[model samples]
Target: MKKRWYDYLWIASALYLILGFFNILFAWLGLLCFFLPLIISITTGSKAYCNRYCGRGQLFALLGGRFGLSRQHDIPRWMKSKWFRCGFLLFFLVMFGQMLVNTALVFSGARDLGQAVTLLWTFKLPWHWAYHGGVSPWIAQFAFGFYSVMLTSTVLGLVTMALFKPRSWCVYCPMGTMTQLICRAEYRPERKKTAC
Candidate 1:
């Protein structure tokens, strides 16, 4: 399949990530990438996001194919294991939840607003330097935290692409895993496992 001009969703995603990094609230917009696709996959039992609109995945393709970085190796069985995939998804979800709560606490006045340099972005250097050390109103902190969460996902996606097949990351992606869970396989009585 040849790449199409409209498939450049990753560029928009990158810009939004940068915005979320500086503005925070924009992180919600970034999440639509996952939530929307998860919703569609639930009804269709297909990874529609990967097929059509995953910006990160598209970036991986560009890196691997356009830059000739892909080894094109078969993914190891360990990575493809359901147990490993689900475990990773669970871990990813927990981290995501924790970040959200942290952001909420800061925004809700339940805690002191943490300064810039969340998670690992620039080791605490404030973003959007145009605003005097990247400091903005308190609301900006919430956005920074959200962008940190996104950075985690972005790093994982990049690493997964580098280490395995381009689409291998999809197998362990939290949103994809969630959709696969909701969209269960077709019923087949003969395929049911019998208690040993």
Candidate 2:
């Protein structure tokens, strides 16, 4: 079969996911790898991950496109409101906080709810079973909750993109928001023509 751009993206996303799982299960190295693509995505104004690399995004785009629901359009006023942006920012902050707290708990021997939950939901199949066995029950619950939140957020982003332009998530994604700030200050924009 001929390889497409999306195939590479899927592979990259799979790598990230595997690394993330490993980070949660055995080593911090996996966690370090997680930030690499994130940095690339932000600095380059390219969701290299989402566009050509993310498995979930690729799947959604394919399905939505096939169903005639993937075309980009304008965002609805209500969805683009300041309140919505603020809410998304707040949610992103909460996710970051959860990650930090969970990491601390795992390190301090508190509990492994996050890891356990991820494993339970993600590793039910035979292939997944091979990768199971790292987290506590409580941590598993936390992981499942985290996964649900992330999945919901991603779905919402896809819906937003379908309603607006591609990468609607870039507008409010916490990482993208931060990267935009940096780029705005560091990278000068090209001058536009004056109406006068």
List, in order, the clash count of every candidate structure.
2, 10
lDDT tens digits, residue span 69-184, model 2: 65677666765566776676677677657766765677677864342323222333222322355655444444444543444456566776677665566566555454444455
Error of 1 at 112 (Å): 1.8
User: Candidate 2, 131: how far from true, in Å?
Assistant: 6.3
What lDDT does each candidate get?
Answer: 0.68, 0.52
Q: Flag regions of model 2 displaced more than 4 Å.
A: 1-7, 11-34, 41-57, 69-73, 81-83, 112-131, 134-149, 158-171, 191-196
TM-score of 1: 0.76
